[model samples]
Target: MRSVAAVLVVLGAAGATGALAQTPAPASPVPALDERVVVTGTAAPVSAGAVGRTLAIVTADDLQRLPVASVTDALRLLPGVWVRQRGPFGSQTDISIRGASFGQTLVLIDGVRVNDPQTGHHNGDLPVALEDIARIELLAGAGSSLHGADAVGGVINIITRREASAPTARLAAGQYDLVQGAVAWRPATMGVFQGASASVDRSSGFAPARDFVHQQVRADFRFGRTTLAVSHLDKDFGAAGYYGPAPSQEWTTQTLVAARHQRPLTGAWSVTGDAWYRTHGDEFLYDPRVLGARANEHRTHVVGGGLRVGGRLSSSLRLTTGVEATGDWLRSWSLGDREEARVSGFGELEARVGRLLLYPSARVDAYTTFGSAFSPSLAVALPVRPRVKWRASVGKAFRVPTFTERFYTDPNHRANEALRPEQGWTADTGLDTYLGGTWVATVTGFVRRERDVIDWVRPDATVRWRTENIRDVRSHGFEAFARGQAGPLALGAQYTFTRVETDRLAGLSKYVDDYAPHGVGGDVSLALPWRLSTAARLEHRRPYGREAWTTVDLRVSRPIRRVTAFVEMANVGDAQYQEIRGVAMPGRWARAGITVK
Candidate 1:
């Protein structure tokens, strides 16, 4: 499972040598930024330019042009986001934003929650295939005012395509005997459209217990105002240093089915409703050869639904209200069988006066076992100039401990049933402006004050780690990004700095303190003559109180008739680094592929 990253550094540089000198092509159309209406930040359909919060949108074109293999790969390029990966290609990953814990970030598909109830470690286990995705919208702040629990840091929403385009088939092979094949098909674009995608990927182990095999299947149906989708993900990967001391093996499967529809009434009134059901199963073997090494097995099922009504009452006022309910059931070997149910109600009002926009929203949630809480937020956006906009938001967010954090017991860790729900207040203000007619630059400062922060702590090396509400913690950060597209060159860059302060404690904390204190990244794509082009991504991450490391990935591709051929190098610098402590990651990987459309 080894990759040849360092050996191919010259290959990437050679592709871009004379590519940008020959000709200067025309850039894209008028909208330097996207005009698509986003739904993650608000109940109303708000355009990217009008959003009052820090939001980043990765469109379909960006997905195809980037040096990435999966949706997670594309997400790593944005600002205020951090991805801690245990496996190289396909495996468990934890996503955090603006210094929040993994469990604090919310993951959703078409506005339906998909966060695992057992643990946040599995939150990255998305069921939908990459080919089925249309775009990914990320909101990098508290979103509990409209969405329910587990939205402390921000929200990630995956939007699927509604209409059909061209069918695609792709095949690729790389080092470590890695093999991949994917196919996407969508029939008709007008009435009653349907789409489906399937993909299979496998690789030999980079090290002991490091091999992985992943598969995904998804189908979607759209007719009139109704949309339906079903997806499943299966994964078998080496847990290795992911959990305890021993090299572990784990297998997981996730399936989700959802349905949504909307009805438009007279005089700017509408109603929308959605329902979803998901099931996940996981089995782990700490070590099959060792006697009493301890193994864990778990299964979880989630059922959720929501109804929303209201719309534009006039040109100046828009109102939306909704009710949501969800149930979670878990069965585990060491965590014991547990279940919980929650119901929530929310309302939002968007008022517009002249060039100013105001948004106010509130939600109340009641849980059978976790009691009730109210979350309220307000956001404002003002156009200081024709090309400049000022935006700011303030809100309260909370997260109830996952079942694993409260009751799961393992050889290396213990749970605490006395843990309390974590809560925090979030606020941010930023300015978005058009620079030099081609660049869209944004700079923002944000902070969060959290109470009863949760973590697994052990006083020393002898005792097992246990869950505890480690008093108070304050996290603050600054984020900035500049993106521009002119002629044949498309450029993007982002910088982030975060500092986490915690009350003095006896033991070391597992995740609350283990964070990337600083990050800098950028993406560059250049179109060359004769359909030959190259793209590269650079990432520099500095772990808290540790040496920093940098990595880059490059891809070069060209088209021939209906097919496109490409080659890629991951971790181009061959930097040896670990996203998590005690875990070792491979250096320098190369792959090649062709796509037929």
Candidate 2:
């Protein structure tokens, strides 16, 4: 099957060029390869067209064209990234990078860590309002050298509302009684200028059991060289018993405010610093019969700050160093847990000589309630040829045990306070080749080895769950993407292959890994005249021991002056399957919407 798929892909490419000498190929609309340069993945930014790993950048224009309601849904389209969906309304999304668990992935909003130290689950609950997003930069594989900690898998940096040269306001409405409105004011100032934005969204949802209502607000102010911002969000939904036997209900609210400043000390020297505070609260209620003891409430608070400085030591030597400290305090009334705090700091340096770039970074963390630990990383990228680049990196990263891992006690599982943090080392290598004005391709292979993997183990014949550190586990994967823009058309495709190995579990018979089987996907888009555009996506996944399924999605957009009309068709092929456990995904859903800017 794999061979057949590969052959078909090759044939398709050939057909796009010209099948035979008898027929002339149609003029392609895709842009030239020189335009594919990317800036991400390594300590020093490199163009996707130059060399490095498989990095994908989601531009503001891309966000405007797609018909997505949540950020998690948008992330699924990226190469080597997975979104574990618990429900349709963005209830609980577990994002995994390069097959790493949720906790191993680090998320940043304007360089601020949003991954709650309390639990990996809340990492996806992004504190920032999505409507205020300007751009999303995703770098796959270990990024501990550039970023610190929780980077075992990858890094996703979400750039929030920044100073724009123009002012913009947008209002949108969609099916399911969904309504959205946003406004932003940007001056023609260069830097250290003030800009602000605000957005709101609400939906009645599509499923009978799923309904959600949410509102988000954000504001930003800048004076001289300093900027301060604050955002608040509230989400209340009806989750009809998706987690337990009977219908369950949950409400979540989170607030975050941050302040940052940037200044230049002297020639070739600059300093930047930022501080943030966040609070999250979750309330859950389960059906009386099935949820025996699942109902509970949880809240968390996190505060931290960091400072970075950059300078040039010599003509060929450049260095960047930084120190960061974060402290977390979480309390759960329902679980009778009081407080858990951790503080951490890190430093990094980068040096470039000729065609080679080297980066080394280290971080040390101290937990007031736990122990202290250290993580170090190193990476190098070299230009093998004018159009070809080679890169590799090795890093150590860790994830602090979550509150649920240490305190939660329920009918199905019992928490263990002695749980230890999960630590891992990642090694990766890749090649990026630019084919002049034709095309650019990137390929990467990586392996992640983790010890003290936290998981639930069956303790008795009753199949009860108990928190324990698995002996050891490993995950290996490879990802590839080729992008080219020719004339009025853009063509791109990404493929990922992963394999996981672990000791067989001793439990009740018949347990599956609960992950997609064979994940491969690609997309194609066309830019037509008169401000019209069209796009298509082909996605395929095979679950363990189950027949693989393929689905196609289609989208069309047209702009008329200050207003745009968009139509989206999900699961155009009407394929039947489930992306997550016990959750039935929608099939062949259609939505039409409009946005005024």
Tell me, by TM-score, which candidate is best: 1
TM, every model:
0.92, 0.86
Off by over 4 Å in 1: 1-34, 189-193, 291-294, 435-439
Report the C-alpha lDDT of model 1 over 196-271, residue by residue, as the tens digit: 8999888987788899999999988776788888899999998887876667899999999999999997878989
Q: Could you tell me the lDDT of residue 449 within candidate 1?
A: 80
Root-mean-square deviation of every model: 9.5, 7.6
Span of ten consecutive residues with least summed lDDT in model 2 = 24-33
Clashes of each: 1, 14
Model 2 lDDT on a 0 to 1 scale: 0.67
Instruction: Please state the error at residue 306 of candidate 1 in Å.
Output: 0.5
lDDT of each residue in 229-337, candidate 2, tens digit only: 8777677766664565555667777788889898988898888887999888888777634636665778888888878777777865657667667666777775665
